[model samples]
Target: MLPNRSLSRKLKIQSLCSNHKQQSSLCASFSASFSSSSRCRGYDDTIPNLKIGKHTRVIFQGFTGKQATANAKESLEWGTNIVGGVKPGATGEHLGLPVLPSVRSAMEQLKPDATGIYVAAHQATAAIEEAIEAEVPLIVAVAEHLPLHDMMRIHSILSTQSKSRLVGANAPGIISAIGKCRIGFQPLPTFSPGHIGIVAKSGTLSYETVGSLTRAGLGQSLCIGMGGDVIAGTNFVDALKVFETDEDTEAIIIVGELGGTAEEEAAEWITEYKRRTKNPKPIAAVIGGFQAAPGRVMGHAGAWTGLGEGTSESKYRALENAGVTMVDHPAKFGSVMKDILAKSGSNFKKMEQSLAQQRRSFHSSSSPLRPQASRSTPLNTRQQRSLHLSVEQNATILKNYNINTSPEPDQLPKSTHFVGITVARSARSPCIIAAPTANPHQLPHRVRRYPFDYRSGPSQSAIKSALQHLQLDSAPVSSKAAIVKLINSLWTMYKEKEAITATVSLALSSENDDLIIYDSDLLFDDAAFKSCKRQQDIHSLRNLTLLAPTDLEAEAAGIMYIPLETPASLKKDGKEPRNLIGTLVNGAGLAMNTNDVLTLRLLKNPQSAYPPTTSANFLDTGGKATASTISTSFKLLLSDPRVSVVFVNIFGGLTLCDMIAEGIILAFKEVGVDKPVVVRLRGTNEEAGRRVLEQAKLPIRAFDEFEEAVREVGRLASGVEAKTGVTEEGDLDEVLV
Candidate 1:
């Protein structure tokens, strides 16, 4: 019978790829070659029933652990061929199935088909490697809090191997209802063997969506939790590839969040899928946290510092532009996705599920904390009691968590595709709807504060108005410490809107020409302008002498953010790099000195948001700084008509002064590029690189004297020093601090 398992699997594979199949031509009959499998034909509106078969064998990577035990019991109850368990002390003992210490032993004995990983964050790598050694086709790792570097290493590992499939380091396992089975942590009762292929980044959000669909009489073809980490094993594109082949999956819904360029990448893939395939699955998606600001560290750690990829605004824009419909928040996932599916001409009926089904699916009477009865494994009476207690405890905890708890089926509104309950925000008007709510239950359909088409203000005029608002119209603002304080006060008192504000022409154009990006993520809005005036005294945390600041002058000029760290004077070396001249900075970006506070009180304050000459703005070059990047960045500031000079503060982490010197030499080669760049070089390779610059006759003051260098950048930027007529622009447009 066990050998028959392998034969059955082979036959099934042949049937799917056979020259003449009786049923739907998923890929075999309609395709010319096996190479055509990549085409993912017959993907629209078909939900393949998940086949639970004997050929499917799984290995639990984290056996004998509490969470692992729960999932293991569920897997066994679901009739999975769970042949081996990788438990520490329990190795060599039988836990119903053989408990092996390592994956090799299990593979030698049972030859499992897939792996369900439930390892600790730190142990994730070893567990995955063991699975690879065992030759498991698909590996789903459900370990959270793995470091970014480790995840990247894992990603590197997966990229090289062709047969090995990796799911996540911080994700729930994937469950294919219509095919073979593997689940990470989804509530099994909530899922039905249906037509939609669901892929999501969030575990809790995925659960909510699954429950909603099940209640709406719609089951899933498969539900995969793609992990909400910086780098997951599988991306949306990979999952979509699988759904494309499955005859059961008629539609594909992807759930993503702000942070990481993952969603944007997914958007490009979806667009290609549409253009290439005849009957592409209509994609519905939910983009989470559109209401939240970037750099705020909202949900997942990956969602926090997306390395400039996962901004909510950028992700939303990219997804929509690619023609993949998406929602604003995660809550309104079902409704928006249903709308998209309906539009795609899928005759999706909102058949209501029975109350008994809902109760069973939600495990309402069974108790969510309790694991279902398992015949494959045995448990002690105390362990059984602990499981029951843990269920109740967890249930109680989740109920109080302000989480979107499982709602009663009948109480759920008769909305399309089992959209989540629209909780009333306030007693006033109903919550406004976010446009483009199209992702499967993973995307939220909330009220968008600003309309996507809210291009009411003229783009150019807005820039001009913004410049004028900063008082950069005629002359640079004065550097009176008290007067600077007042302007800063005016900035602090203004109320700022909580939406993403746009920017201008030469605003970091080299990086992204599509939008002429702002210098950084921080940009104050009109509301911030209003709120600044109401404040009595703007707390002067630190005064910064910004050299050639084009972006910060208009954006931060007079507003405030909380937990604001004091700024430090950046010179050349040892200490962290702060603004020595016309550079922009965020709090965590720059290094600080113990004396930054003293300097903030002593410095001559500048009028606009730009810091005063006595204090330097702490704009760390955001890692390595080459000369062209500096020059381009400087020019970006210079184009703003507010910049008078540019100051370059580089600690030279991998970026040596010689390369910067070459970049400066390159800049000088180009006419009309004459910003005085004050060079601060520190660290290894500085001396040789400096000599190269001196030999090249690049007009750079390579300095070992850190403080002296700052003084120079400061003096020129202060506008009190003798004006160098080196600039061809007639008058100084920008000054780097």
Candidate 2:
């Protein structure tokens, strides 16, 4: 909103979305003074365990409160030194924890070493003040919405005069599970006691990371959620320091995203930590919202930007250059860490066996992460970019235009015909996977198969006949192809997929469904919203296979529910690992059927808003034909484990090559990375994308090729690739190159 473009406007805080709404910028105000030569990263590692004060205790100021009570009880269950609570009038009474009228009283009696402040944002100032007065050396503020100025002032006071450590204003707190103490609301069930440490921005991502690590049979020395707000109290470097000191913590996972220089700062600290620490722990990372445009903010209130390092792609790349290994998907991050730790010299199978048990228990109908409350957000712009980026070291530099960040991206015709196929028999499915003959709708078709609360098989003839009734059963028969083309011009396939995913994600929040993506009460359910969300996650194609429209005119069809088996099926002897590693990411495909090459030109970069290298990909894919091209591209892309991601950007233009089904399989077989390959094949030749993938015997994850891929890609990438090893400087500059 500023008149002078160069004169940046200070960002203001916006309310966190209670429901699925368009995301706003992540920028906000904060006061910071960085000493360019300062090496704060090593400082955490050097804080010897014996050097700190003793008798650590926690004071949940809002102890009797809802979240506070739950977290407090859980903390107590985990052996946290919850000394007491403070209620203005009820001074000398006790509930679960002891009751103290004031911190002064608690301080005089307990003489605690560390304190965690669990109070509302409005009360944070007073709580912090009390902690300071009592001289608590460590403070983790577990609340959101503390005004920027208040945080600035509080931080200033805490940093200058106090010995206390202010961890967060909106954080989920920390856990040293094995040490028999914790400070926040980490579901005790998911946290097994072990050696890995975590530092993350989003709570969901943190939980998922823990889940992944647990699945890999690893336990956490401490899994910390720094929170997603911009002004979190603790930085990545701070958490790393804790990991460095914990004897149980053998390695660390530093989760980051685009927007803010925390990762870069952490990178700088790594150099110093390497020099200072005799035994350095391995680190890994996973960053999200890579599709976000430069200058576009995503999460956190205090996570403001000054130029570079504030984007997802850049942050992850920076972490990688810092020598972290890529976990690829959020669900697999622990594996990456395990591998690094093994390389760094540790018990790999012990971790793997533990993980096997965890995975075995995945989706035990009783677990929380079910799809019942599991939201269906459309593919976001960030996810979309993650799909298409050929080599994304800096995800923020992704092709923004490729993503479908809209709730209304899905706009199907009031009465439209689609080109679909009726599958008679197959090793996998007995049902049908129909797609738009011409991909005019630019939508994706996804069928989620969770370990628990899965869908029963829908009738088949009912589905096959639905397509036949519309005279759309056969492929390539486009009656209103022109009209479809026109409609596509007005909307992108990715956007349409987003709309559908959003609509369904919101609509299917049936109270009966126990799908719980987050432990908190954040669920999105709205028909229109779901449609829009679905549209974004997809490009252009409906999973006519699963959506059996019950038209009386349609015949009865039978489907055999596909099992959600782990890839590379493991044996009793444990020699074979799981195969078919499929994940959901921002939907965008790799090299197009049209453009053969897309060079980042890292050496001779352009200074234009539309970089020539990237622009060429768009121009080429928007053009023309071929059958083998689709599969060949996938094969080429999948060959490199580093090129683990495969994106399908479906505009109504060139990428609509006549047959892409085969491409999905070739990439799976040839690429052999077994990583995630997000597909968004829309526009002209979308049917081809579907037909080929459906034909292969390989177990590949095929969805409606639309924006659904984009949003899904984000979810898939949210928790993996935690920071690892050491990092090298200067590779981040290669994004523009």
Candidate 3:
């Protein structure tokens, strides 16, 4: 049995008994105050059944756009109650639905309960503002690549008196299978009506997990894709509160990944909820990016893991400590849930048996699962070419920002002890970390970390308190003063430069107890570089040679690309390197899951003729991509001499498959492909895209089934028949049983 199963029930009974004793002694005035103050109407309000249902009225902000029109048609066909849409400066009907000029107009005429914004990234802020201005209950912004500052401003607005609940700036949206309501672009065939509730940071991972649940006969009640950005409007705790009150939702699944403390926060909430309830719902989580390297940003803007508790291991431990079942892999989520349910007692066992029967009956039919896809003056030029600054360069830059820096090497006194200090942005706030070491590469376990308010900055008193806590109070007064001044300077630099992290090495001199800066490393926010002129001036110091050529090319081509393995890492002393399968995916989650499934298949068959297989790179063309962008992505992949095959997996929502197909054809004509190319297209405009690919007569193998496409890609990469056979019905009886 799971750890929290009966324990939760017992605790709930005790809580009830305790509450009964207190109820008689409660005063009438206290009860009235609690009732009125507890339920304020806001984003975090605990409104029961807040999940979109069959009767929830929805509207679109970009009603007249190609993406919006196509999505609206699908929603209407799927039985979503889309009353109308808002298209500024446009009128009349689109897809047989009334189109107004603005969100306010639609609110007046249609009284929509929710609004899905399908505009471009640059226009998303205005769209969200309009929806909030109209007080739309639920607002879903499906645009990706939104500026970080823009999201910051939007978050500020949301923190005010607004009544709207914003979903995604780059989210896949929400879907309620039981109600037949779809607010965003979720693969319809993979979903079924059942009791499980899912909240995920990645849309593609949510789709993959949902497919597994449905295959196990545990269909979803509601699936929410909390957008993957640095600052999201709705977070894990917000969704968990909603799920706790949803009567249809009996169990919960959280799909988290590397970067951010959302999972840890969720764990904290679950622990509190267990203490308060008798029979709290069981939760199971599958966190991605176990293989992710530290300090590497994997696809999502918010998925980068620096030092501290943002790693996947930390997240797993936190959730496990909270008594939540931690799944090892995304594919294993369903089976783990089944095991939990079976151990939940007779009632849950019966429900599990009923779901198993449903799975058998459903697989017996022919329905197919859908596929899911600053610089100073002269230094300005030098800064543009360098990724990080040298100690001298950093000192110079800091001084220009009104920050203090240690004197030059020749001016420093004889050193006796070395220490390290780092100031970086953490999940909730900016934190300062200090250690008594000179080795910059090694982070000691016994370091002191202090978190302070970003707005107020770190004060001298706070620095002294940290030093005292670390037992460094006996250090020379001059040395302590120097450390304080340096840290204050670093905090100022961190804020003004819009840096992700700023680190420095300090040497404490024996003479007069002085401190000198030995080395420094600074990592600025890339978003700030693009959005702020000041940051751009600082970016001029970037060294082009420091970054991967393919990354630079991808940036120029307007696509997101992250190299999984370098050619040098793949080579042995005297053996041919492993074949690299380059993936072209549209969503960050899908790209990651594709890599996971492919790696699993390769590992399952290790003795293949084509050597071990692995994804060479993770590429996302984004939701609002064009044919030219797709062509550019293919060209970039082909440019890599190590790539043996290219896998194009797309689940068209805002991105139409026809455009993707057209891009492949364009790449064939322009760059000339020599490697094996495998393509899988699903979602909006899939049929048209497939037709275009077939008509092009290019040397591309296209498949309607995701698993088949994956298998073919594996076979092409490994010169042998791919193993781990999965049926079109997703028959995982072996694993599930």
Candidate 4:
């Protein structure tokens, strides 16, 4: 009866695979080579649904950056098949691997299966788009604080246009210690190959758990850090589904934190799957930061307790009720998992028999099932052209990002797809809808139209003159309403008369309209100039609306986005320069808290010579800051002449403080520091982080106390050269008068 049920399911899967045109040829060959029973066994192997493995070739985005270069070397050393790296201007340059400008170019040259991204928060969106467009099977982003809007855009691309699986925006990536391949930065020594599968949001915690498991004679099949961002690319349920089907993974370990309901969601999926299939897998979990104070963020971006839903107690109750073994601490994760596996011997044996039966059934049949390689087929030129942007526009957009541009417009391939832009002119008014030229490489002329004559003094006068010319001077409609009506009419006219598939229709009326610019996610190629790319600021184009068939698609184009005001320096008559306190922190909550604390203290201190009006601009390092980003940020501050002193506050969780220290030291080397800098390192590996700075012997002041670090910044601002001594052991706190 069970064999019959399995055969029926297998047939259904084959039928579905028939519709998968991308996999059809392989499927047809599979059907031709394998008997009906053998085909069932063949599909069983793919049941795991895992995309990445040890043999998967990968490319590193942001390859020239400090962290990427260092990590890529380590990955290569470990025998990871790293094909190349992508660094916009440094293409053709080799840092142990071929470096190209974009993911598409890298795809053309290397044909890598995956991309591991190491870029800042602001640039992550564009990097994601490139990877998705190039159709990389997997992407692992190692950064955090990705704006929710930008994440949404990335999510849309993955869901609709691509079949790629994104691992993290603030994640540590995935590691198959037993398989001997890692996609993200992980402590390799702690992991060993075994039957246990582990998943977590905290990288540091995962390291501790993996070590514990290794010590207990338990090895991991795969360990994944799903990221500590609010919107992680992958989740606990996704990991569990893969692990459930993984032949290597016998049991699962979940190391959850205080924030986020990912654990609860995973519990629900597990409960349902168990109820339906009754093929239960042993699972143990450890929820971290239970003793943490509410409203205070832990080291992770997503590890904050705002609402009660993501609390440790809530997650504990949910998982416990779902029949999962719960460990009080990560140290006990291995032992508990072992006990569960020991007691579930019968279940394990039963599952083994079931898988064997499926394989045996196929082997007994007079046919063989073989795996095939994937092939890439280029899209037809007309189909590619229909995507709404020319190569010239794409190059222009890339140039604006300071990225390497394509060859001259004339050298680029032309697109057959064309859309016309014309202004609707009446005697009383005229209008201009800005759009990119159809082919910048061929035609350098721009189309521009204004509703009123240039000689007219005001918009109202122009409208009135145009109205008089049209014999409608006494029309009852207001100028704003009239303009809106004209825009709608023109949009309809273009669609009906020109049979245009895509057009950028604009309505210009400043009445109660707010200017909004979206730069990171949605603006790419020619879609950029059609939206808000050409305009320097959103404020100037608030009245204009970009008309597209899909507004979401327009937003996904890498349009310009301006962040809120942060810290800046101001000069006063070239006298005494005020302190421009440049702060660098790992999380937004910490950055805000640091700013608030400094502001309150400065205002309350009566003896302070400078007014409480001190300004600060906090550079959020996101939840995961690599040594490279740390060095780059420090150098950026040094280049800014406005900054008198710099303050670095880091609360390392998954991001090791020692790595941050390495970056700071690298920056110190790149640009010999003249400005006074204060650093406060906390959380995981804080001591090691401080020691790195102490050993550097640069003009950096390390502090163990947060208040003291803040005070040092004030002293430096007041032109006081406060000095402190460091212990022989590099203990920063030992320094005193």
- Candidate 2: TM-score? 0.45
lDDT per residue for candidate 4 within 108-185, as digits (tens), equals 889887889988766777888778667676788877656433554355334322246778877779877756777888
List the global CA lDDT of all models.
0.44, 0.41, 0.67, 0.53
Q: Give the lDDT of residue 575 in candidate 3.
A: 54
lDDT of 3 at 200: 90
TM-scores of the candidates are 0.43, 0.45, 0.73, 0.46
In model 2, the Cα lDDT at residue 511 comes to: 35
The better-scoring model by TM-score among 2 and 3 is 3
| Two-way TM-score contest, 2 vs 4, winner | 4
- Candidate 4 lands at a TM-score of 0.46
List residue ranges in candidate 1 displaced over 4 A.
Answer: 1-55, 88-95, 305-310, 329-356, 359-737
Give the per-residue lDDT of model 2 (tens digit) for 184-210.
655555667777888887554565567
Model 4 alpha-carbon drift over 4 Å, by segment: 1-50, 296-299, 305-310, 346-737
Which of the two, 1 or 3, has more lDDT? 3
Q: What lDDT, from 0 to 1, does candidate 2 have?
A: 0.41
> Model 3 lDDT vs. the true structure?
0.67
- Which candidate order results from sorting by TM-score in descending order? 3, 4, 2, 1
Query: By lDDT, is 1 or 2 better?
Result: 1
Ranking by lDDT: 3, 4, 1, 2
The predicted structure with the larger TM-score, 1 or 2, is 2
